[model samples]
Target chain A: MTGAIKSQSGRLTEAEAIERAKQGDGEAFEVLYNLHKRRVYSLCLRMTANTAQAEDLTQEAFLQLFRKIGTFRGESAFSTWLHRMAVNVVLMHLRKKGLPVVPLEDTMETDEDTTKKEPGAQDASLAGAVDRLELQRAVEALPPGYRSIFVLHDVEGFEHNEIAEMVGCSIGNSKSQLHKARLKLRDALKKHRAEKAKR
Target chain B: MNCAEFQKALPEFAEPQRDTALQAHLRSCSDCSLLVSDLDSIVAAAPSLAASEDPNPQIWLQLEAALKNEGLIRQPAAPLLVPPPQEGRGWRLSWALPVAAAVALTIGLLVYRPSTHQNLQSTGKTAVTEPAAAVQTAAATNAGINEDQDLLEVVGTQSPTMRAEYAANLKDVNAYIRDAEDAAKANPDDEQAQESVMNAYEQRSMLYEMAMDRSLP
Candidate 1:
């Protein structure tokens, strides 16, 4: 048996921590939980839009992370691996509740109502003009598919192909979803701006 | 290009690619140009979330209790590794039964994985591909052996700016290291947790080395 790790002198690496967690090191598992809880919670919050649910899911994700720590083959980045697990957990939870993971076909339209003004074509009334927080709220208001695409592409910096693989959509569909998501955000921002102007 | 074509290409507008027809359309069409600019801002204004806000700390206790419920990491604290968290003693190691198992595992990893050794040798110089085992062995090798002098050698090699950045980030690193220490020293009977501690250290070393190596000309 190898001696104690002499914690004072040596720094912990993620790989070492994961191996320890797999061996049932509760403290090592705690470190892993601390390391990733925020991102996991943030993802849950974005997906669920409920802080309590997000917190619950974050806890659930870590619990699952520790349980499944042994199966981690080290093929991908731990962050990627953990995020993927979190996404799967969120998706699974959403499915179990019968919530919509993808929006209806009608919602896929960039502008469902032709009569409504084109949010993108309007200068000074959209995008940069909108409050940052308002824009984020607008994002929060997006449909499941739109929100996931937007978060994965813009906020999370994933490639379209990666997004497609993650969400099980075609690459073209991913692009179209992003476009629609942006359009929705722009429309919401435009409305916020108009309302602000009136005030 | 027409409005749809221009809009489709908007995501790539950040790249300097000129389309004569697209340029002509943008030049003549106010609506198209406005839309293009709007799309650009939508992309630009997105908040790159890093989970900046730490989650509630109670989750740690919850997680630990849950592990205990599952029969993991429920070991009695070893005699040698009982440094309290409030002690502010910097980095420390917890030697326990699970940690001993992890040492064996680390040795097994080192012996079984030869490529990892080669990868460790030139860590900062090249991109380290196999992060799992390779990072663990490399990081663990340096840890606990020479402690202060070794850290100086690694940190000392970095550029001043990099060293400053390392100093700034050390608090978090120390915290992480502290977590590993607490687990191993306190109650790492569950070899899983001990293994995780060792892997975390390896990854930290790889990151530290990678950061330091980047500053080299």
Candidate 2:
């Protein structure tokens, strides 16, 4: 009966929840939290690779979200806005800890490994050689730069331009880094599979 | 196309929609074909990877308590996820339950019984409104505290962090209780002070119940 909108399930839609949350509705904020905590927390954990720090960042991101929710003008999808905020939270924390953010400059020269051909990767029609668990482990073990681009591109499904905008890198840098990320993940997965075969 | 050219263009081949030339190269060139297949599988598999954990409720509790401490929201009747006091830091809290109960009971008896109510209605004063009334009410409040001690003990053993959280949340609630006590002392018959003191008691009870609700594994 109130002016607030509700979705089909009788719960407030994300937009309504956001509106209520902006008005200082705690339950509405919790509704938003419950809906996206998994994705946000997962993004934080993947980016930081430290559970405690990730948890801290997750909370910090949401608190910052609450503070900045007023500024959101519905220009982008809420998820994109939230994910970008989460990414920024992790980046800021990393900066505060004096961890160097790998400058995402466009590189003209290719890396030696990217230039090297993977013989097995060339002709084979892929079956199940790439294990999900193995690949996941490889990703978690990636350096922060590669891990983020990979997660943002392949995992979170952001386009190169979106990735560039979020991380303050060029679209070209995003594409380059994503290529390198995939290559490193391939190497990591191959090594993992080989180690398991040995065991 | 030679494998060199095919390999160089592999990044382009990774896009979801490959142009005819790239697809043609992937079809004819074994090495390029295999590379594309492997890369395709990799891209397909990436989105499934996720962190295996979520931020637990304690974080929410802390954030909310912080917001409340900063005077952001109107004070919630009882704080959420208040961690109990840290062990050996018991002196920081004012055990408002006993004192609050005493005040509530003294006020109740003064206004409730027919004879007392009639006398107070007629004269606007009662025998039980004297300072001695609080001393007598203290005995009943001590019994209530002893019972609450059991509840606190049960709530205490659950999580050190939760108890710590309870302590943090109660710190604010106690501040409210302290302010109400100041008002009550300044004006012994102040209705607002008496109501606030009782509200603090009710809020404390709700906080204890919140602990019980949370103690479930």
Candidate 3:
């Protein structure tokens, strides 16, 4: 077991904490959990749109991290590694529940349809039109496959290649899914705005 | 450039440089321009959503209990201190861990058959078999150790992320099986001892099956 080492701020650096955690230090594990829990939970919440399920998934992700922390060779940033694990955990749960993470037919769309104008493409631009809360609600209402892609690409800032690897789709499919997700979200925001005007 | 051509190339425009044809289309077409603007705004606003929100504090407590139950951590003489949740909602410790183990064990015992091994190997895809069955059958018959070694070799070929965890878990389960087997041998007449040995083998079989599933591409 490695001794606890602290930086000038008198707190254990993430590296030191990881080392201690690998040794099964409970406090070190807690430290790592606290550091990453909110982000992991937020990811789960966005993907599932259910707080309780997100919480459960968050717990499961951390448990997995603890079990595998000894294997952390630091090849990538810890957050990146953890997020990948978190994403896999959520994806596996969704898969077990029989939800489509990415529909094969959607990914197989011809280039012509992929580039064709979406319905109501002439609507006012969503630039500055939708607020954060409304956008979030709209995101929650998206189909499971679209929501997963949108959240991973747009919200989580993963590259198309990374998203493809994580979700088991081709890079082209990831991009197409993200674009379609945006188009759907645009339609949703426009509908919300129209409803607000009626009110 | 027509709307179709411009939109076809739009995803590439996300990069800093935009070609003159796409630019010219954006200049002439209001709808295409608005589509670009809207997509950009959506992309811009997306990052704000990444701002982290804390989960309920009880989650850590529940997680701690689970880790302890798995023998992954030492039990402290006293409960570790943590801040209380703002609400008085009582959290229940889940029986999922034990229940899942029991289910896996049942599956392992039910699926074990000696004949399936040759079929699995013939396909060159042992992972395709029901994990518990493949593992339980392997562990039960004369070729148990060699089959497990072969499974471990397959596991070794998996990606790094899956490999370490599988190795660690298999090591733990193997130790558990040894302990149970020794207990049964030391008390041959005890039905409880015999049952413990059976349960331990079941657990080992399930763990091997889990490893196989994870090893799949």
Candidate 4:
């Protein structure tokens, strides 16, 4: 084991982490897992919504990370490469379940001038306190495909190009979906507030 | 730029270096500003899922087991060395054991008659036949080992991105196999591709099995 395999932190460098992982160092892998597990799990959870499925997805991603770590070339950041892997794992799960990839029927065609809608009684009354919880629910309510792009770009702060690669779509497609997602979310939140006001 | 274009670019605007024009407009445009605020709240409220909180830890346990599974461990397969099967002179000299000498007449009748059916059966037992294919495969493996240089050279040669991509590609291939299998089951009319798909799956599964076997504790 070269010292390069173990960086100054006694953990392997990214390159060495990959090399050692390929050599089947479960401990070294545990180190790699420790480094990225949270981010991986976060992506899985936000993408899938269901905790149970997210857990399974997270495990599968790491097992895959273990099985396929040998092929990780350091062209991009290891996290960037792994982000692609993690995203693929989620997409594969959705595809297996026959979940919709892109809701083509939803073309952001709603004509309602959402800006004209008033904030609802609930949103108006509780205001900022429950706003966080409501916002969380609204995001969770977005379509899976839209939610994923929304989470990656809006929440995780990945660039469109990066999201494009991670989601296996063209850069233009990522941007469009993001635009559509933002529109739909704004519409949904506006509707939620209006419906609450009517109550 | 159009509002649609500008709207899509709002995320990019969240960057510290937003274009001055967009920043100025967003400051005054309540709709766009509220949209940014709403996006901000949504992002701030984004749920954080920790794998540690998962109810079933068995998957990790299985993974640890898989890792610890004697099969996954990288044990240097001590070269399959046959100690030349201890050749002895007793079987050579007497052609038998002490009991065989005592039963000399029976041995003679079985061994001496070259044309006899009984003699053929007895001779077959003494001859140990090795498989040609097995021998050839062993030879090929030996040649492969000779071709490979030291471990470091082989490891050093592979780029890290290649390794990660290789892992990812295998995953993609595995997923394809899974999809093909599902397709085959759903629409058996595509029998030709189905068989080919199944065969590829079997081959890949064998590779996984072999890896698992090698890595097992």
Candidate 5:
């Protein structure tokens, strides 16, 4: 009841596990990390596309989390609080390297002749109406802003207000981005389906 | 509301409150129905992307090491939507005890009383008690001794510029004292000359030491 129990129990009734971890209990913090790392890492991966950069961003995000965890209050759900932190970490990493801003135009129209050059070109012959792989490829191929908004809103289930605050934009901007994301996703799925038809 | 507004509100509709008008539209409009189905699929596929698994064990190790090092429970760069006020409270709280202790110590030192002592060697003075005379003599001698010790300490520790200034000032005072002694030998029983010479020497010594002390980093 001294270390681990104190932190876990203390978090529920007295303070949160995150709060306790900030006070210096490594184990208590580990529990909090385990709970959120998957979603955080996934967001980083989808944002970066490359495994190495995603891993680096994920690690940096968690490191920053620990460095600044003392600032967290239970005003928002812990996951929501962590999501804002995670997204900022990825965005900052992208900004630092001057990575191309994923344009907002939706690029929904892919040239038919260039279809075979897409990442999932080999999967064109695979048989399925809609699968996770197809959806993931579609999401990943989305412009960064729309992909991020789509993932945060539809995939991660954040509200537009939360997305707006995290992404540094207005709620109106978030909704517009989500609409663009959805339309792009819908187009990609349509193209995917059309490709299936030709095979 | 028309289908466009209804569709915009459809995402919001999932949260247990679906407007009656939107529900009515959903029942009638095939387009809205398809939109709902499309949203359902998007939502379904959304979690699968979330299916990106936990990081490798090494990353957990690194994260744990990082948290332990930083004493952090969550990410630090972006604060939560609502940051905790406890951190500010804690920051302010940290200074309270140290400040209180410093104030107490300063007060205690300021109010401290030194012990009394007597002098048997004082030549009889009118109203001054033997003990008071001894105390005054002791204080004067101690002051002179402390000044000399302070000068030596400063010489040992001060930077070269300060040391050179101090050494030069000390030589000038010594020379002035020598000149005053020569004058005193030449003209004995001149109280004014003796007093001025003594005062000049004491003031010079004090200035040299203070300058030395000031020059220390």
Candidate 6:
């Protein structure tokens, strides 16, 4: 059994586990799930902002990986492939719930107006002063379209082109949505600070 | 470049660049400079937010059951956590009898319904045991429904949040099963529809298994 073998060796390396899992080794599948579940769950949690949904999506994502592990050809890093699959699962769930996954191009033009810095407004420097918890709350407040782009780009560190391919948007659209997402976050954070001041 | 242009280009901007026009604007305008600083802070802080969180432990149990049901697990893996020698053995024995009995009953039903099995075989189709398979499916679905009821009873003992989550998930799976059943009835000859019905039953079974695992004392 793969579990017995792991007990003797301490643990199997990821490559060995992937090879074993491809052969339908249940222990190898568990090893792979343990290796990736945290990051996968975090991605889902950030994307959905709801623990129940995140938990369900995390299960679905791993279920998908298990079903398709036979077809993985190592064309990309395993983590990259898994992350892409996880993103797709979350997006599909969101679409089922009637949330827009991608902002339309016309809406993008209108969104830019909202993102523009006000004319001659005084600027508050958030550099070196932002609270992590506050930022998290602000992130969760973003609209679904902006949240998806923001989490994919800034939080998960996928580049624009890679994100474009995963979400089926142009590279330009990915960057634009990311910038708009940041602007929304900025406004959210500012509002949080203002509310704090009032209290 | 004006403030709008500077902010517009900011998303693509790399730091420490020698763009004199953008640099001059940043040097002159506090708002754009602070905007850049704020956006930079956000990017710098983003990775910290990516810290991984542990999911509920029952997820793996559910996943393992689904894998086994799908025939993706050829070998039964070792238990996830080894309990102390004194524990869980009685619980296992207690449940094992009923489950074994259920399996025996299912097998007995299949053996006694030889006419249905023979009729399917006479049809000369590749799925020669379709009727027998249907009988087994019906038995399994009944078992799944009973397990779901048992799960709901114990689910009330869980935290309200968990109970709500389980109820919502169970409702969704039941709805999926109904849809798949309708599809299978409408297109009885469609292999995909038959597979969908089976998949739906397996999903519900997995959920019940997961809830049962969580309910253990």
Candidate 6 chain B lowest-lDDT run of ten: B77-86
- Give the local distance difference test score of model 3: 0.66
Off by over 4 Å in 5: A1-20, A99-130, A197-199, B1-36, B64-217
lDDT values, one for every candidate: 0.58, 0.61, 0.66, 0.52, 0.55, 0.69
Residues B1-217, model 4: lDDT tens digits: 4444556466444441268767776776665666666655545454332221212324444555666664443633222121222465222222222222223223222322233423434678323322432353345334323322221122123333223322432344345444544544353344433543444334333333322232233
Question: Can you give the lDDT of residue A14 in candidate 3?
Answer: 75
lDDT of 1 by residue, B25-85 (tens): 8897787776666767777777534353334444555666777788766552111222343
Query: Could you give candidate 6's per-residue lDDT for residues B62-92 as a string of tens digits?
Result: 7888999999888766432212325655355
lDDT of 1 by residue, A70-96 (tens): 889989788887887887888778778
Query: Which consecutive 10 residues in model 3 chain A have the weakest lDDT in total?
Result: A1-10
Better of 3 and 4 by TM-score: 3
* DockQ score for candidate 3: 0.19
TM-score head-to-head 4 vs 5, winner: 4
Root mean square deviation (Cα) for candidate 2: 21.7
Question: Docking category for candidate 6?
Answer: incorrect
True contacts kept of each: 0.34, 0.38, 0.46, 0.15, 0.36, 0.56
Candidate 5, residues B43-138, lDDT tens digits: the string is 666777773533443565566656656545334321111112265633332333234323323322222211111122234442454455446434
Error of 2 at A46 (Å): 1.1
Taking all chains together, each candidate's TM-score versus the true structure is: 0.59, 0.60, 0.61, 0.50, 0.48, 0.63
Worst 10 residues of 4 chain A by lDDT: A121-130
Which candidate number maximizes TM-score? 6
Question: In candidate 6, which residue pairs get closer than 3 Å at backbone N, Cα or C atoms, i.e. clash?
Answer: none
Residue B215 displacement (Å), model 5: 58
* Per-residue error (Å), model 1, residue B86: 15
DockQ of each: 0.16, 0.16, 0.19, 0.09, 0.14, 0.23
Winner of 3 and 4 under lDDT: 3
- In model 2, state the lDDT of residue B48: 62
Q: CA shift at B92, candidate 1, in angstroms?
A: 25
- Cα displacement (Å) at residue A7, model 3: 7.2
The better-scoring model by DockQ among 1 and 6 is 6
